[model samples]
Target: MTKGSVRSANGRPHSTTGGRPPGRPAHADPSTTGGQMTTGTTATTPTGPAPLRRPQWVRVLLVMLRALLVQSLWFWVWVLVPAAVAIVLLDRFGDLDMSVVQFARYGGIWYPFALSFIGVGIQFTVHVANGLTRRSYIRAVLVTTLLIGLAYAVLMTAAMVVERAVYTANGWAPYTSGHSASLVAGAGSLFAATALAFTAGGVSGLLVGIAFYRGGALRGFLALPLTVSPAVVVMLLTDDVAAGRDWTFPATVSTVPLTAALCLALIAAAATAFHLLARSAPVSKGLATS
Candidate 1:
């Protein structure tokens, strides 16, 4: 009937307001189009900054431990594979006088000793630069040192046991190069000696690491006896329960338990000394000023 108007179905013309009610605005919300609320839009709840989380030393220790293990994978591969081959070849052809397992013992010690230096020399600066506290890094390293030493001890002991079996099967003697006659008499004794020695090496590494880090080359050199004494003493003690070759302590007093206790005490002392040195050690200007 009229422009912009539509007729109802009953044959009567009803005006249309362009499909919108006359009183409603053109840009009115669609939710109120029919006097009813629609679920057409979503509301976002405001969020605050993520809650601060304290740094976890356990996590740091695990991460550092894994990194150390991965980094040393090549070392173990090189050492174990070649050493195994050499043992077989030497036994097959050469008249070997001593056990080849002894090499692994010394290697187990020296490798951890060397690794300790890197743990502090590089990791300390890296941790500091990354906003980690020195105390946290030190604690992680200390725990990692113990764990790695134990791991090496288990590996070395297992190798020794396997070697002993092979030697026995071939009618060869698995004679250790240590001064103590009973060092390799039993698997338990062998493991104890290995664990004690390796742990001592790790702790000694920390001592020397902090020493060199805190002091320059000259000072570190000067402090060698003090810093390195723990490892040396433990190694010597493990080698020979007696200070004198002619004089030996009574078997009851020179038990592995006593030896372990003494070695643990020495390791604790070295670790304590390292903590003291590291606490006061200044961060190198080249690494991290703060």
Candidate 2:
């Protein structure tokens, strides 16, 4: 019989004077549990979000290519329409001494100026599409412009070759000096020259983009000078060269090297200006006016 059950008629089990069962864990105080003690050891802290990455070159390239393709299409239409009209007018009148080749050459010389306008359009479109930094956009523009200029030079040279062949086959002598060799060399030179010009222009456009991002409508006025300065210098030098005059110091520079040097200088100046402009704050007053 149990010790407590010997004298008690009730059937309940007796307490063992404050002794607990074997292997049972101790109980925590209810007051301590209320005061902020936790059972788990590890605490979970939240982390901040990661930064957004810069865009890839492929994305930038695609944006640039699309702008170029569209601009080129429009450019072609612009060239063709005027040419067709001119051809019709000439045919209606007496046949002139000028061949289609001559007309094409004249048109091609003016085409670079036309491409400047296209460059502006490309700048605007690229800004809208990529939201790229001014520098990145400028790089993309320069690359695209170089590619377009190269392609144009190649096509123009090929056309000249075909024209020469046709003229020869028709018993007309090609009158140009160093016609075949010049065609090849001139194509290379023109491509280089155009690339330099485009790079200069792109640098100028980058300045404009920065100005626009900061100064808005007033930036347009600033942009005109930046974009036109290279052309102005080039035109002046070319005019002097044509007149057989040497305007620069040292007085003995070759036309090609002088022109290339001037272009490179303009590109450098424009790039420097762009760098300075990009670092400055955007002009809120100008934006407000716009």
What candidate 1 gets wrong by more than 4 Å, as runs, is: 1-55, 175-184, 240-254
The TM-score of candidate 2 is 0.52
**Structural similarity to truth (TM-score) of each candidate:** 0.74, 0.52
| Best model per lDDT | 1
Q: Candidate 2 on 127-150: residue-level lDDT in tens?
A: 544445555655555566556655
Error in Å for residue 12 of model 1: 41
Q: What is the C-alpha RMSD of each candidate to the true structure, in Å?
A: 8.1, 11.7
Model 1 lowest lDDT segment of ten: 241-250
lDDT per residue for candidate 1 within 1-290, as digits (tens), equals 77978767877666676575455445546656676544435455668887777566777898888888876677667777887788888878996555565576677777889889767888777777787777887788899988888887777667766766676577664443333322334666666667778888988998888888888788988998988888887776665422112112225645656667788899999999998888777778787764
Task: Quickly count the clashes in candidate 2.
Answer: 1
- For candidate 1, the lDDT comes to 0.72
